[model samples]
Target: MAEKPTLRWGILATGMISSWFVADLSLDRQDAQANHVIQAIGSSSLEKGKAFVAEHLPGKSPTVYGSYEELYADPEVDIIYIGTPHSFHKQNCLDAIRHGKNVLCEKAFALTAPEACEVLDAAREKGVFIMEAMWTRFFPIVRALQQKLHEEKAIGAVHRAFCDFSFDMKIPSLGPASRLKNPALGAGTLLDIGIYSLTWTILGLEPPLGPAPARAAPEKTPKVVAAQSLDDGVDVATTIVLLYEDGRQGIATAHATVKSQRDFARIEGSEGTVIVEGDAAAVPSSFIVKKLDGEEKRYDFPRPGRGFYWEADAVALDIAAGRKENAIMPWAETLRVMEIMDETRRQGGARFPVDKD
Candidate 1:
């Protein structure tokens, strides 16, 4: 049997998302195709870094750094996982790329498409692998559903998709400087949660999805129209409609005032419709397909440790193969989605400090 590839990870933040990613990496899954080693941790201070290790990664002795610079300079680290807020993603990715380290940055990839372009350009110049950590796209259940819809044509000729990623965030109660309400932190329903709704829209509408057709970037960009309700300059609710070149349409809505139902997304086609169910859009676990003939089928996936390990494993495999980007979640795709958000925010009247000219 061939030996499994191992990727050494340098964690760049000591937050909840980072903890979940590291914990998933630490799980001993017999079916995992690659090995993920938490090589180091970089936090704002030594105390916080040490506390993160003790609590989330107990019994593992990864070198901890008090500063990001120290972590970036470490020679033993193979890749840096940027779990910081969206506002910091561009700089974090640039710093890691400057150090010639691979990166898996959390989404929304940046405050806008232009910012995402800079990061991707830097990685391309540096010849290091980098991918936006849209982990939900790598879920086994999502993959199976896509295969059924797009490959098998289970839902023949998709016409429209509706997706919602709403939850009661109680935005009014948060302080002005809170991450949920602060524009400086890239706070907005469109960027924070609406991106998932857009993801579902794209997944349901785009066909033959394997790195969109060559030189079709212009044709692939959807026509976007949107509206947003703001709370002290932060978007509290948003609705975006994407019109495709082929006449298909997708409706994506997000808000902070109500919890979304378990079946948060529906893709309707000529022959049938697919209903997606999950705790949230970010952790989709199952789907049901209902045909016009009254036949129905359901698919369920067992999620372990937030299901982040799938993307981590893909990163390891990509790096092992000397690739600078992933086919599943490539740079172009990241930019494509970021462009959708950019247009959505533009039409919706949501602007951040970084977006200022």
Candidate 2:
């Protein structure tokens, strides 16, 4: 067996998401593909970064950089896992790429499709690997579901998919300039949680066919129709419908202010419908397959960590093989998803300030 090449990761921000991801690496669990290391922590202050490292990357000491520039300049870092705010992704990835670090950026790769393109184009030109960290795409259950629905034809011609990712994040109390409601910060339910709904839709309707850069083959962007309820200029509730050329459709709903029942997603097909149950859409635990002929089966995937490690391993796998992108979540696919969100925001009239500028 070829020795797995370790990918040294430089975490871009010290946030809850970043903590979850870093802690996943240190968890001694079933997954032994321990091929990635947290080399550095970057934050607005060295003290904050050091605190984060001590809290999450426990038992191991890594260099803490006061600024992202310091982390980017470090030769020990091989790749960057960007857990910064949505508005910061483009600039962060650009900086990381300029320093020749591969990137696995947080979802909603940018505030808009154009920004995502800007980052992707730079990565392509620099010959460095980069991908949107849509970690759900790398989850064990999702992987098994993809093979079953697409390859095995278990569902037999999927017609539509429906997913909802909502939480009582209390947007009303978060203040206008707070990260949840601030337009300049790329704040909205669509980008925050709707992205996951839309992700599941794409997974069901348009499973990517391996990593394809630009100039490979162009397909029409998904037709998006959406509606949003605004809360002080931010989307508090949003529903988006994604339509494929083949008439397949998906409805993804998200809400930010009010509490809603945590729902399981369903994909309807000719033969059966697959339902995924999750506390949050991003972390699904099990799925039930119910066939039209009255047969049913349940597939459960208990996560070992916060379920971020799989994608981290995937990043290492791609970089080790000298690949520029991940087949599971390709660059073109990220742009397409971002474009879909842009369209949804446009149609829903939920424009961020960044969009106006």
Candidate 3:
């Protein structure tokens, strides 16, 4: 057997998400498909970058930079991870792509579908690997359940699915400038948590694996109906209903004011139902398959580090294989989900700073 490929990562932000991702990469998982090395950390200030490295990585001695451009220009970096706010994703991705860098950008890929298109188009032109970091889709639990439901036809013909991601964010206590309350930063339940809910619904309804079926025309895409509750011009809660052409329905929801149940999602089929439960929709760990014939099966996954390594491992393998996009979370899927949120926000009246641009 040969050694796994190594991918040097340049982390572009020192936020909470970046810390979690780096921690996962630092773990010593024997089953990892590839080796991940933290080559550098980029921050607004040199001191901040150094602090992040010291705090999150401890003894690791990765290079720290005061600016993003330096990290992008570093030849040692095989890829750049963008953990910036939603509003900054488009520009951040474009800048990295311009530098000929592969990218793993966090979800809510952009503030709008067109912005997402611009970034993806740049990556395609650059001929580099680029994917939205919707890490949930890469989880072992999600993969197993998806295969069981779609590939094996475990639940028979699927008809409807519902998913929700909600938490008591204590929005009232947050200042106007806080990312959770500031419209300028793209603060909203839809983009933040609702995207996960929408992702689960899509997973339950669409078969991502197996041989490609005949491409459905644009008109075949589900019709989106949505509603939102606003607090001081920011959406605090949102609900979306996707009506498919064949009469199948997918319901997705998110909220900032209340917590959701452990069983946050369900996929109903002709013979059985799949009940998904997780600490959060974004970090699903287990699920149960209950059939009409009285057969029940359950599955759980080991989560050593918030489950970020699954996506990172997949990304490294893709880069090593010279693929320009991920098969599981492909650019088309990212754009489709972004468009769904775009329409959802449009109908929900949740406007961010990017709308004016």
Q: Report the C-alpha lDDT of model 1 over 180-236, residue by residue, as the tens digit.
A: 889999998988899999999888887534643352342368889899998777899
What is candidate 3's lDDT per residue for 1-357, written digit by digit as tens?
A: 977999999999999999999999999997999999999999999998999998999989999999999999999998999999898999999999999999999988998999999999999999999999999988988879888988899999999999999999888999987878898888999989999999899889877643224433323569999999999889999999999988889999999989999999999999999999999899887899999999998887767878899999999988898888887888888898999998998899999877852
What ranking emerges by lDDT with the best candidate at the front? Answer: 3, 1, 2
Tens digits of per-residue lDDT for model 2, 154-218 = 88999999998988887767766677878888888999999999888777765546554543353
Give the residue spans of candidate 2 off by over 4 A: 211-219, 258-263
Measured on C-alpha atoms, candidate 2 has an lDDT of: 0.85
Question: Each prediction's TM-score against the native?
Answer: 0.97, 0.95, 0.96
Itemize residue pairs with steric clashes in candidate 1.
Answer: none
Each candidate: what lDDT?
Answer: 0.90, 0.85, 0.91
lDDT of 1 at 144: 86
Model 3 lowest lDDT segment of ten: 210-219
Give the clashing pairs for model 3.
none
TM accuracy, model 1: 0.97
